[model samples]
Target: MKPAPFLLTALFSAAVSAAPATHMDTKAATEAVSVYYRNPNPDRALKIMQTIIADPLWKKDSARHNLSVWAAQILRQHPQATDKWCRAMKQYPAVTQDETAYFFFLANTSESRKCLRNLNISNHSKTYIAQNTPPDISSLSNISPADLDALWTTFYATGNPKAVEKVLDRVLDYAKAQKAQEKSNHKNIDMTGVAAAWSARSNIMQNQDIRKIFDTYLNRLNATDKALLQKILVQE
Candidate 1:
């Protein structure tokens, strides 16, 4: 008479629910719920989520705001799932900014940038988040380099090159500032590292071929530097 996995998951979820909704507990709960959703049994995940939601504690706990976000993400990931969770996200405007950004990234298909734009995010913060995301390379494998470059350009521009150019200029300026700071703080800064950064900036400014620029930059690096850069770029 072993308990079912879903029952175990539900019990664990209930234990989490009983804890005081501290910021740390909220984060843990979000992650636990996400793991449960990614489980093969969608029904089980749905049941666990429903149990958590039905609990009177969550009904009044403002700290569990992020739980709704995780629920939306879980629902979106399921093939047969409805848009109910997405609608719920919209209803809860107090949802975390990161959660909102993640929702657009997950749910929107036309363009991740377009999704962000529709969120009415400020221009300054948009680039920061978008660049950090660096489109999933695997998903883009079928996408031609030219198409990717165009997509990236369009994303940065918000469909307007003139407006995006300013954003690019600011990005370059920030890079330069960072380079200067690194040189000043670390006297042994590698020259090749500096050159690669400049080359990347040049590529962006010229709207030149990004892949080619990356290749050229990589070729110019020393063996040690190349290895280091590869380690930084390539990840699971």
Candidate 2:
């Protein structure tokens, strides 16, 4: 009996998507930050964010915990208020120091860089980051896909074949798992159904981030790996 392709696709997609997602902020707050990234024009992102946070939802002390990265950026411009910043960051557990540091890193403002340097990150985090500043390729698949994407994006900020290789390897790991499903299950039955999709209707290469890496690192992959990618991507 043939299983309809969409059902498998949807089931696999749902499994992949079911990974615990980082909490999100209001749509307005998200757009404000995305707007800045797309354009990066002078003060517009900041001004837009400033306006968005002024919404009544943001004013309530109880709701302040949901403040997004966009709101945090506007707050970054305020005069040094360590106590306030501490309290606010404490409240919004979702708005992480990693997000904040990465935001400043992307912003590339002198003040923002200073803020990153001052972040109260632990020594363990500092060492892990220093070791994996470029991010290790061999271990990419061990983390959640969201973290994988974030790390890939960070490494892509300064593109290299090594980083691209890591991204492709992570994708390949799952694809191979799909191929090796019969063998992988004996080790872990509870998650075998969800850890890897049997097939992908959507070529992962279609994703812009992944596509960029594919285009950049196509030659670096061996013939066998390339063939595997073609299968996973549903290409002839």
Show model 2 residue runs off by greater than 4 Å: 1-44, 47-141, 152-165, 183-210
- Tens-place lDDT digits, model 2, residues 169-213: 555766666667655646443232232322222324323544555
Q: Candidate 1 residues 1-236, lDDT tens each? A: 00111112223345566566554444354344524422445455445444554454344333233333333334344535433333333343433333345434533344433445545444545666656543332243233322223223332212223322333333333444554576485555444334433433443444434434445555766786555444433320
Error of 1 at 203 (Å): 44
Identify the leading candidate in terms of TM-score: 2
Task: Tell me how candidate 2 scores on lDDT.
Answer: 0.41
Best of the candidates, lDDT:
2
Clashes of 2: 1
TM-score for each of the candidates: 0.28, 0.41
